[model samples]
Target: MLLILPLGISYLLRTDGIATDKYIDDRRNYIEQVLDTIDSSFSAYEQLIYTTVKITEELAPDKAEHEAALKLAFSSSRSALVYGIGIWYEPYSFDEKTERFGPYIHHIDSNNNKEEITYFWNTPEYNYQNREWYKTSLAAKEGEISVSPPFFDSDYTYITFGIPFSKEGKKTGVVTVDIVLPQLQGYLSDYNFSDFSGVYLTTKDNSIVFSKTDASNAAIEKHAMEGEQPGLFTDRTAVYDENEITSFFEGIGQKPEILTSETENGVFRIHAFLDRKAIFLNIIFRHSLQYLIFFLFWTSVLYLIIFNSSYLKRNYENRLLNTENERLTEEIFKRKEAESRLTFQAYYDEVSGLQNLNSFMEKEEALQPGNDNRSLIQVSLNNMKELSLILSSTIIDETLLAFTTRLKSVCPLETRLYRARGFSFFVVYDDQKTGSSQKLAEKLQNEFRFALRLGSRDIRLRAKIGLVYFKDAESLEQVLAMSQSAIAGLDVADSGRVGLFDHSVQEQKARHVVLDAAMSQPGFISELYMLYQYIVKTEDRSPAGFEALMRWKSSVLGSTVSPAEFIPMAEENGLIIGLGWFAIEEVLKAISGPLKNSGLFVTVNVSPIQFIELDFPDKLDNLLNQYAVDKNRLKLEITESSAAAAIESFWQIIDELIRRGYRLAIDDFGTGESSFHRLYSMAFDTLKIDRSFVTGLNLDERNQEICRSLMNIGKTMGSQIVAEGVETEEEHRVLREIGIKYSQGYLYARPQPLSETEFGKS
Candidate 1:
C-alpha cells in the first residue's frame, strides 16, 4: 500500500506537468492568432484610407463628389467602426488672418457660402491644431499619407487613418477618418478559442491604437485626448482595483510572450502570497486526458472487486471472449468496410486544365532520378502578354492544351511534364546518353518552331530552353535554379535567337546586373558625354561649342561601350528617360559656362519620346535662367522622321523652344520622310543634309540632285541649310555649289575639339 501511494503521487505530478506545458503552448498560439487577426484588420483599414484619399485628390472639385464618396465609405464599412470617414478642413485662422488650421466636418456645403467658414453643427468640436493627425499630415509633403495614434474624442475615441489631399504640387490641407477600435475589438471577440483573453494593437512607435480593456478613467481620458500621455503603461505583472485588466510592456519588438505577475491596485506586494499558494496547489493538480482514462479503468477494476468473486471473474472472461470474437469479425470485413472511405483528388489547372503544382510534386517523388548522362531541360515561352492580347481566352486555353498534348507525344512515357509557372515548363531527360545537350536543344527548337508556324501569323510562340547537366548538382533545387538562370541569360543574348549556356554565362549575367543598376541612376548619360569629350577631343576649353552625339558608356563594363550595344539595352529596360535627361542637362551646362561669352552654340540631339514630357519646356526655361545662359546659344536637333511622325505635337514643342529664344534644327534631312511640303509647313532655324548625300555629291548625280533639292527646300522654308560628312575638297565644293553655306565635315574641321573661340569667328 505504501509503494502504491508513492508511485501514484509521482505519476500524477508528471501528468500535470505535461498538461501545463500543453496549456501554455495553446495559450501562446491563441495570443499570436489574435495579434495576426488584428494586424490584418488594421491593414485593411489603412488600404481603404489611402484609396479614398487618392480618389478624392483626383475628383473634380465642387467638393460635392468627394463628400458623397466619403458618405458612401462611412455607411458601407463595418458597424463597429464608429466613424468610417471624416474630412478635416484647415480653418481660416483669425490671428494669422488666413486659413492655417482645420475644422472637422461630415460634409462640405460650398453653396451656402461657407467655403472658408467652419460649420458649427456638422463639425467635430476639437480644434485641428491640437490634434497630432493635423500636424503630421501637414508636415508630410504633397502626395504623402500618414496614420495617427488612437485617442478619445468628445463623441468617442477610435483609431483614425489620416490622408493628406493637396494640389498636384503642394501640400496644404488634409482629410482624416476614424476607424473605431471598439469595432475591431468586437470583431475579434467573435473568436471562440478557449485560450485567448484579449487583443491589443500598437504602432511601431509603441503607441497602442486599439485595446480590448477599458482602462480609461476621467483623468486618463482627459490626458489621452489632450495628447499629453504616452499610449502604453509599464509593469511586470499587475491587477488593478478588483478589475482583471492585465497589461505590460514586456516583449516590445519581437514575438509576443506570456508574462506572469501579481500586484494589486495602488499598493500590494501581498498578491505574491496568493501566487505562491497557486503554484503549490495547482502545480501538481493539473491532469491530461490519458490520465483521466487510466483513472476510469482503475475505478472499474475496483468496482469489479465488490461483486461475487467467481461470478465477476466468469463475467469478465465472457466479456473478453466477445471482444476477441468482434476483432476477428472486423479483420474478415476490413477491405469491404473501407471501400466507401477511399477518395482521389482531381488535378487540374484553373487556366489551362493541365496538371498543377501539387500533382507535379506527387509524380516527381514517384519518378526515378536520371543517371549521369541525363540533362534537365527547362522551356519558357516568350511574349506571353502579347499572345494574350491577340488570342481570345478560350483560344489560349485550347492552344495550351493542344501544345501539351503534342509535347506528350514527343516525350517518353517515363518523362515527367509540368507547367511550372505561367508559360514555363520543365522536362527531365533520363536518357541523354544517346544525344548531346545541343542536339536535343536543336531538335526541340525545330519541332516547336514548326508547330508555332502552323498556329497563327498574328502571334508567334517561341521557346527558350535551358539545360543543366545533372552531374554537377547535389540537390534538385540547385539544378532547377541553375537551369532558370541559364534560360534568362539566353533570353537577353541573341535578341530573339536561341541561346546555349556555357562556362562564360555567369560573367555575362553579372555584367547585365551591373549595367541595370548603373543605368537606373540619373547621371549615366551626362557621365558618358563627359567620357566622350575626354577620349575623342583631347583639349578641354571653357566657353566651347560642340555637338552632343548619343554614345553608350556601360556601367557593367567600366569603359566606353558602343551605342549599338547599350542602346538596345536602354530601350529594353526603359532607361531612356534617364538617358534623355542626362543628354539635355549636359548640353545646357556646356552652353551655360563654356559658351557664355564665346559666341558659340551647343547643339544636342533629341528623341521623339522626349517631346511627350508636358513640363519639358518649362524645365528647360528654369535651367537656362538658373545658369544665366543665353537661350540663343542652345540648339535642339530632331530627326526629320521623328518630327513628321508626330506632326500635330511637333510644331507645338518646336514653337515653345523657338519662343524661349532657343534654336531648332531638322537633322538628317533628305534621308527620313523629309519633303519640301513638311519643311514649308513646319518652322525650323536650320536644315542639316544627310552625310550620305553630302559625301557622294561629287561622284553621283542622284546624290547631287538630293543635296541640291534639300538646299532648295531649306531656302524656301526660310531655314539655313548645312551639309554634313564632307570628306574631300570636291565634296565641300559640291555642297558650296548647291548653296549649302553652313558646311561641317572632316574636310573642314573633322568635328575638332570645341576651343573657346571655335564658333566666336562665325
Candidate 2:
C-alpha cells in the first residue's frame, strides 16, 4: 500500500508539471493578444489626436504663421502623424520702447496676472527667454524637433511638441503645439488591471513623462513619485519595497531593437516587461490549460464509446441522409412543375392562350406622351355576330379563331390586340402618318370584300373597323373609349365590307376644326384660380377641402374638358411649370392670411413635369417667405403614378420641399401598385386615400380592409391620413371611425368661392 501511494503521487506530480507548462504557454498567447489590443487602441488615439489638430488648424487659418504649416500637412499621403501638423503659441504683448518681453502676462481667460521678470528675449514683450519649451525649440535648428517635459503654466501643467521655424538658414521664431495630458491619461486609464501592471511614457534621460500610479496604495504605488531620473536598484529584494525605486526600464539605449530613434516628428517606442513576476503567476493560473486537461480526459472516453457504436451509427446516418436526399428530389420536381405552370399562366390569357388585357394596357401606357404620334385602329368582327346567330357555338368558335389569325396578319408587330368579350376586338397601332384611318378602313373593306364575294365556297367575312387617331385623345382610357365607341357604332351598321364607325370620324373632324379653339382657354393656373376660389374651395366633402382642379368650359359645346384633360395639354404646351408656381403662390397667400390661425393647411396638386424646373425651390421659398406662413401649413399633393415615374427626382423634390418646411402627401393611395416598401422609403407626411377606395368602402370589404391597412401603415410610418370621395355622412363617419384625420368629399360642401361664410364653416 505504501509503494502504491508513492507511485500515485509521482504520477500526479508529473501530470501537474505538464499542465503548468501548458498553462504558461497559453497565458503568453493571451498576454500577447491583450498587448495587441492595447497597441491598436493607442494607434487609434494617435489618429484621433492628429485629426483633431488638423481640423482645428484648418478652421483657424487666421492664426499667425500656422496656415503654411497646415497646408503642407494636408498635402501628405500619410493619414497618421504625431506632430508637424499644427503649431500652438500664446499671444503676447511686446513693448517696442522697452525692447523687452512684458512683465505681466495676460491669462487665457482674459485676466491680468503679475509675476517677477525672469528674463527677456529678442521679440520685445514676447517673454521667450526663461521658458523651457520656448528655449528648447529656439535652440534647435531647422529640421530638428524637441519634446518639453510637463511644466506648470497658470495652474495647468501640460506637455508641448516644439520645432524651430527657419527661413533659408537662420531661426526666426519658435512654433509649438500644446498637448492635453489628462486626455492622454484618461485614455490610458480605461484599461483596468488588478494584477500588477503599469503604462509609462519616458524620455532618453529616464525621466518619467506619464505613469499609472496610486498615491494611497503603496503596494501598487509607482516606482518614482517625483525624481530627476530613474535607475536600477542595488538589491533585487528591495525593488519591491515601497520606499525603494525599482527601475522599470534599464535605459532607452539598452534595447536598440525595442527602442526607436528621434526624427523630425519625435521618437516612437513600444516596450513591455519580458521577465515580470506577476505575469508568471498569471500564466500558471490560466483557465485554458485547465479546460484542456478535462477536455482531453472526456475526449479519450468519448472516442472509445464512439468506436464501439460506429457501424450502427453509420448505417442509421446513411438511411437518414438517403431519406433527406429523396425528399429534396421530390421538392425539386414539384418546384420545377410549379415554375412551368406559373410561366405559362403569366403570359397566356386565362380564357384563350393569347395576349391578355394587361398586355394591351401595358403597351398603351408605355407609349411616349408627346413624340410618338401613334394612331389607334380598333376592328370589330361583324360577321362573328351574324355567325353567332346563325351557326352552332362550336362553328362560331372556329370562325372566331380564323378571324383572329387574319387580324394577326394585318396588325403591325408592335400593335397590341385584346379579345374584347364575345365578338368585339381591340387593337393599338403605333406611329404611321401617311396611312390614314381611311386607308386602314379601305384595306379592311377590301380584305372582307373577297370573303363576302365567295360566300360558303370562298369563306365569307364581314366586319366594321373603327379608326381613331390618338392625336387628340386626352388619356389612354379616352383613346380606348373613343375607339370602342366607333367600333360599337359599326357593330350595328348595315351589313357590308369593313367601314370606319362614323362617330370617331366625326369626332376627328370636330377635333380638327375646333381643337385649337378647345385648347384656347386660360392656362391651367388661370383656371386653377377660378377652381380654387369656387369649385375646388367647397366645404362639401366631395372634393371638399381638396383643391378641385378645373377643366375648360366651352360656351358653344356646353360640355367641359376636365383638368385631367387640359393639365396634360398645359404640360405639352410648356405652361405647366408657370401654372404650378402661380398655384403654389396663391395657396401660400390663402394659408398665411385667412387660414392663418385656423389650423387649416392648403394643398395644391402639382404635375410631376413641373418638378423639372430647377428654380422650383427658389419660387417656393419666395412664396413661403412672402406670406409669413409656416412652411408646415402648406401641402403638395402628388399622384403615386407620377411619383413612381420619376422616383429619384420625386424624392429629391419631396426632400427639398420638406427641408423648406412644406409637407408632401401622396394622392391616389390605393389606385397604383405603390408597394409598402416604396411607401416606407418615400417617408411621406400624409397619404390621401384614392377616391375609388373611398367610394368602394360601403360595397367592398376588401377595399375597406385595404384602406384600413394603409391607414395602419401610415400611422406606423408617421403620416397623417386623408380619405377622399365621401358623398354620404356614413362615409365621413366611417372614415373618422377608422382613424382618418382628414376627408374630402361631397358630404360637406361642393367646391365654391371662399367667403366669410366659407371661412366660418371651416
Candidate 3:
C-alpha cells in the first residue's frame, strides 16, 4: 500500500498537468471566438439601421404621406430586433401644435399603426420634445448618432439609437432604433464564447443593460438610466469605480475570469466571465473515467492487504488462547531433554542420546589438532524406508531407541556417538579406546546377536558399518563423505561386513566431479556418439538388430568416460535431456542417410526424464516426419525402474509414441525388481535381460533357473526375450539352450560407431 499510494498520486498529478496543457488554450480561444460572434451580430444591426435611415430619407417628406417611413420601420421589425424603429422630428417641424412627426413603432401589436396614424393622438409622455433621442439628435451633427438612457417597460428595458437625418443645410429630423432587452439576451445565447456560468452586456456608461447574472437589481437599473458617478449618464464608463467592478464580480459568485471586449471604440463593452471553478470542473469532467479506473486499482490492492492483516491478527489471538498446546509442547521438550545427558546435548539426537550429524561433524573437526589415531564408523540401517511403510511411527521410534542403547553399550564409554539421519548413525573413537577396524567389527557383530523385545515382538535390526581411519590427511567432512559412499554400496547380506573407504572410491568420486564439470561446457553434446551393438537371433545366430549405446570421449578429460559412469551422472544432473536428444537426432540421421532401405532396425536408449517430458512426443514426431524414417526401424529402450514410478504418465507417453508408429522395449529388465509384472501389465514389444543374469547363467544354478523362468514368462507375455552381455559361446550356448530369442555382447561384435558399422555386415 505504501508503495502503491505514491505511484497513484504521481499518476494523478501527471494527468492534471496533461489536462491543463491540453485545455487552457482552448478556453482562451473560445472566449475570443465568442466575442467575435457577438461583434458580428451587433454589426448587422448597425448596417440595418443605416440602410433604414437612407431609405426613410428618400421617402416623400410632405404631410400627405408618412406611410413610406412607417413601412420602412415595419421592414426593420421583421428581425425581432428592437422594440421598434421610429422617426422623431425636431419640435414643431410639421406645425406649431406638433412637437414630433411620428414614432411609427413596429412592435408585436403594431399592425394597427395605420389606424393610429389616421386618428393620431399624442400624449405628453409619448411626446418627442422630452425624449432623449429627439433632443440629443436635434443638437447632433448630420452624421452623428445618439443613445437614450435605457428605460423599463412591463416586459423589457431598452435603450434607443438615433441618427440625425437632414434637409438641405438643416437638421430636420432624427431616426431612432430601440433594441429589446430580453430579445437581445436571447440572441447572445447562441454565441457561447467561454466556460463562464453567466454572461451580460453593459452600456458605455458602465450600466448593465442585459445580464444573465442579475436582471432585477434596482441599482443596476438606476445605473442604466441615471448613471453611477453623477447619478445620471451625462456620458461613458470612466465613472465606473472599483466598488462597481467588485459588485459585478460578486454577483457572478467569484472573480470570474471576466473577459471584456469593446465594440464601439471603447463605448459599449461585451463581457464574457469564465469562472475559475468552471475551468477546473471542466478538467475534472474530462478525466473522470481515468480517475475512476485508478481508484478501483488502488482500492483492490489496499483491500487485500487489510484483509490479510486482519486474518493474521485473528489467527494470532486464537493461537494465544490455546493454553493446552503450550503444556503439551513443554512436556515434549522435557522428554527430549531426558534422553541425552551431556553438556552439548542440544546438538545430539532427541530420540537416541547420540550427537546429531552437525555435532558429529564438529567433533571430527575438533579432533584435527594434536589428533591421536581416529576412526569414524558410519552404520547404515538398510531397510528403514521399507519398514516405515509397515510400522507405526511410535513403534519405529521406540525400536530405534532400543537399537541405539545396544550400540552405546558395545562402544567404549569415552567415545562419542551421532545420528547422521533416520537410517544412518556415526561413531567417533580414538586409537586409545579401539584397537583396529577388524576388532571393532567383531564387537559390533557380537552385539547384534541379541534381539530387542518391543511390545512382545523380537525385532532384529541389521546394519552395515563403513570404517575410516584418519590422521588429518583429509578434512573430517571429506572422510565422512567417503565413508557414506562406501556404506551406500555395501549390502547387509554380503561378506564384507565392515567396508573400508579406499583409494578406488576417491578416484571414482574425482571422475564424477570431472564429468559433472565437463557436461556444462559447450560442445559437450558433440563428444557423445552412438555405438551400435548387434543383437543376434538364437534361431540362427544371425543379425537381428543393434542396440545404440552412448559413448563419450571427453575433450576436457583427454580420455573416454565409461557409459556406466557418465550415463547415470548425466541423468542425475539433468543434462541427459539434451544428451538424449542429440543421440536420437544422430540415429535418425543415420537411418535417413546410409542406413536407408537396409531393412534393419536400431534400438536407442532414452533417459527416464526425457521419456516423461511433455514436449517429447511432439519433438519426436517432427523429427521422424522430417527424416522420413519408418517407425518400425527405430525402437526406444526404457528402464524398468522409471516406468514403474510414474505408471500413468509413462503409459500415456508410450501410447502416443506407438500411435505415431514407434516401438517400445524394457531395457535392463532384471536389474530392478524384475518380477515380470510390468511386462504383463504395461505395453512393451520386447524385454531385454540385464547383463548380470546373463553373465552367471552357466555358473550359478539360480541364474540358470531365473533365465529359464524369464524366457517362459517373456514368451507368455508375447515379448521377445533378449539376453545382454553374451561374451563367450559357453554362456551364449546356455542362453540358447534356455530358448532366449536374442543375444548381444562382445562375442558377436563390440559396439562400433556408425562410420564403422555396415548395415547388413553384422
Candidate achieving the largest lDDT: 3
lDDT, residue 352, model 1? 52
| TM-score for each of the candidates | 0.43, 0.35, 0.38
lDDT (tens digit, per residue) of candidate 1 on 229-248 = 32332221112221222222
Q: Given candidate 2, what's the lDDT at residue 410?
A: 72
Per-residue error (Å), model 1, residue 169: 9.8
For model 3, the stretches where C-alpha displacement exceeds 4 angstroms are: 1-510, 674-678, 699-702, 760-762
lDDT of 3 by residue, 1-762 (tens): 567767876777677767655565566566566556656666655655665665455444443345544554455344545566676565445665543356455455422222223212256656666766577766766665665656766645677777877655567677777776554554554455335544546666556654444223564555455443322222221333435554545553555555566664443565555555556656776676566556645655566567767776556545544533674587579667776454455587777767787776655654463464777788777656546545777988898998888888888886778898657887777776556655776578567666789978987666777887666335777777777876765753553477777778778778788889998788888888788888888768888887888899989999998988888887665577888888898889878876887776788988865765645888998999999988888989888776655324446567778777778888878777644554576557788888889885788889989888878777888887899898887898898787887998898989987677666353
Please give, for residues 156-220, the per-residue lDDT of candidate 2 as tens digits. Answer: 44555556543333444455544444434344444442322333344332334445432234332
Worst 10 residues of 1 by lDDT: 265-274
User: So what's the TM-score on candidate 1?
Assistant: 0.43
Q: Report clash pairs, candidate 3.
A: 226-232
Candidate 3, residue 715: lDDT: 81
Q: Model 1: which residue pairs collide?
A: 90-101, 90-102, 91-101, 543-594, 543-595, 544-594
- lDDT ranking from best candidate downward: 3, 1, 2
Error of 2 at 47 (Å): 58
